[model samples]
Target chain A: MTDARRPLQIVDPDDPRIAAYRGIRERDLVRHQKRFIAEGTSVLRVLAGQRRFGIESALILENRFAGVADILGMLPAKTRVYVASSDVIDAIAGFPMHRGVLAVGLRRDDADAAPDTARRWRTVVALSEIANHDNMGAIFRNAAALGADAVLMDAQSCDPLYRKALRVSVGAVLTVPWHRFGHADAMLDWLETNGFALAGLSPRGDAALEHWEPPAKAALVLGTEGPGLPDRVMDRTQTLRIAMANGFDSLNVATSAALVLHHVRNARTGPASG
Target chain B: MTDARRPLQIVDPDDPRIAAYRGIRERDLVRHQKRFIAEGTSVLRVLAGQRRFGIESALILENRFAGVADILGMLPAKTRVYVASSDVIDAIAGFPMHRGVLAVGLRRDDADAAPDTARRWRTVVALSEIANHDNMGAIFRNAAALGADAVLMDAQSCDPLYRKALRVSVGAVLTVPWHRFGHADAMLDWLETNGFALAGLSPRGDAALEHWEPPAKAALVLGTEGPGLPDRVMDRTQTLRIAMANGFDSLNVATSAALVLHHVRNARTGPASG
Candidate 1:
């Protein structure tokens, strides 16, 4: 590895090499830059293991590097690693960052990112117009944990690769296959052509989730919290409702999705596989 | 009601009447004051309908007051309602509270807060050492949505009435019966004496969650995210596990709680009740 590409020490917060990492807290820096900031030791480790996305560089506190040097070495030697004091990191980030470890990950392209039809996904989590990053991240985390094969988000939904979303996902976003492109209607048509059952979750559904058995291939669709799936979307898919307490509001979108996915997976393969 | 007790107008940020609402974002003000701050119109509505706790006061932005005046009327005439401009409200809160609705709720006494045996709660959610307010709040929300009768927290758990937890719960904490006092072991003993199955959730448990039939009455206990329920507690209960994909981590504590509670309820009474 070249000297310029090796691990470097950063003393000044205003170092031009780490300019992209500045003002991270003040705005959506990563999304606008077509990259993402992965925080904490665990997320950084995930960024290193995957080749689907590029790990641009990393910034770690001096004391924390000894424990994580092995993980950081996993990244290509060309990936610049900057070690700094806590004060310099806090200054560069525009606030105190307790995690001390941060890395900027380059997102992959959108073309041909859909699931392979040949493999025939058992469960696909479909989310529409999910605006909150926390919910989006939690959905991805649930999709991965409950054994969903892929995660498909409509164009209206927020980016799963958003900094906070990736962090909340506990690095599942790096592992899970997700695509946030194309019209949802087109995606529904594709799923239908693939012989997949499209199950839309709603409070006013025709079938209770408990009674609706999972088919060999299925796409579970969920919408934003307040409005839920629109009329057109609901009409196109079989609606499934989770039983709620008398007149109580619906469960959190991600929570409901977990229950649905867990049930569908268990019903299909039995809980012993869980 | 006296004229002095009527809804009053305040233009100053430092007004002593609204001082308790100030610096809300800075520290754990509500917990220190032995009160909780409820935000948003939806939560305010839930607080208004419940008589278990006392409503001490409210602060609302001038523009948003007209839409909620009727709900405000639901409170007693003596409840102090302070109307303030957006600028003053933001200044007093030390941050912008977009919902424009805030209220201070006085907590009730803990004496005899345990579940009533005569009613025979179908399901109970018992948590151990849950520290995050967001997870804590989500647990209560799930308990309410999935029809868990009450929430019992071990001594190490954080307060559900903390402002952020209350907001995340969507006022479920206000409506749900919860007790934070007493040793977990004693509570487990009481639950067993009352003919309840003590099911402890863990990844390394003996019984798969799907295989374990929901008894007539059950108490489902979960722990925090990383280090799950202590071994001492796990040894005292029947272990139940949610199957995970190969080498994957466990689901969020709150998400798992929702799945368990939803399953227990549906199994006991069937999904038609959902």
Candidate 2:
């Protein structure tokens, strides 16, 4: 294929062009190198719909995929694509081919574009060490859906733009703005400085969820499952709990967040519906 | 190893002992055959704690898993416990071993054990074809925690007993009594015969959730993501919309169910606390 007309380049597995798709399952490569893979037509379709997320460096598909040529034609004139035998593509990725399409892109920083009014923000989500990409994505998806204005990740937070996170979010990560706070203390300072009420979601809190009304603009601080929010973080925030009947312990983090966000949103307006 | 106490088995890749865990990714076994997997120490602990769910066979770590052993001790003395090296276990499952424990359980037969009190039930959740195990588990977890009395599943519904579903539910699947309907018509007939009011959750519903004060007992039917409850189902049930801002399309089914369950629970008790 001529370079100008070929938006996608079909290459051999050994081609240096596809290095980004390698060793996705290796923890060290994933953690230290900060790279992952997004495969399949659905992910590509969603990524293409969001141009602002960034450039798609490579496209790998089976040679006979029906509409691969059409998608390649639609890419920005300069975009690079790769076509290979399904076996070759699977060999590079170490997994079976996904519906004959995959793309490699930069892992955008969670703090890529900060919210203008971070200082004035209320009803934010503070994530600490939430390493599971799917959970992180679900939280962002839920946060965006439930009207969370901002997201601040603590030191332990996973890359919000990781392919798994983005795919799980269904591209919501690109739309809902987020940032990172390297230090937990810095997060506390921001919450306090902004005059935001921080509701630390923990089982130890004295008040049941029904007992307290979320402030007009409050921040709901959620931590990873099991250990939950750290004591240091909770110390700076109001300790509130969702009441579970005897025997039950707590709700899933996203489910709990959704409950909290829903109530906080409801609180913004009068209870009785107009 | 003694056969009685050994509970130990070692097999090569070709051994039929690992058949159940094989080919998980190739086929939608959970959908086609109505099967699922339960995993990990947290899950085993939950299942053991809740006496209602049955204990099927299990794979246990031969070393460094005190929690798994503790849970296994609670299983029926006669139940088979296969012991293997962690690496062997990992290879058999096609994924990293989760705290050295996994169980396979039969799907609940809704027709056999649907609570007889459907006629007396006020709050209910009807899940239609929600394929994501995590979502299914989370929704059930939320429903159980939020005080929803019963759960009904349509034909397309994933088996809540599936392993991932159980893990996500924190074993609430066992604690929360549930029933399955053979078809949508069967579910509707049970609801109608029980004199239950149906609230179909959808984006286009005429009634906002805030305006809805679900009666002492009601059924909140939730459709899967994207195309919500079928129109016929919506027509038969009252449309209860969870109001959102302009840009957001809809909440995740699990998230939506949590909101509705909490709302209905609060409404039954009176207004939400501030």
Scored on chain A only, each candidate's TM-score is 0.92, 0.83
The models' CA-based lDDT, in order, is 0.83, 0.71
**Candidate 1 runs further than 4 Å off:** A1-6, A27-32, A110-112, A115-119, B1-6, B27-32, B110-112, B115-119
In the range A1-274, model 1's lDDT, one tens digit per residue, is 3432356899999999998789887556334356679999988888888887888899998889887887887888678889999999999999899889999888657422555632657788888889799998899889888888888877788877788888888888988887765678877887787778899999998899898888788999999889999898999999999888864877899999899988987898766733
Query: For residues A206-254, what per-residue lDDT tens digits would candidate 2 score against the true structure?
Result: 5667667778568788887789888887777888787664577888887
Decoy 2 TM-score against native: 0.86
lDDT per residue for candidate 1 within B144-219, as digits (tens), equals 8989988888777888888888888988988878876467787787778878889999988888888888888888
Against the hidden true structure, what lDDT does model 2 obtain?
A: 0.71
Best by DockQ: 1
How close is every model to the real structure, measured as TM-score?
0.94, 0.86
Which CAPRI level is candidate 2?
Answer: acceptable
| Model 2 agreement with the true structure over B18-42: per-residue lDDT tens digits | 5665554443353534344567777
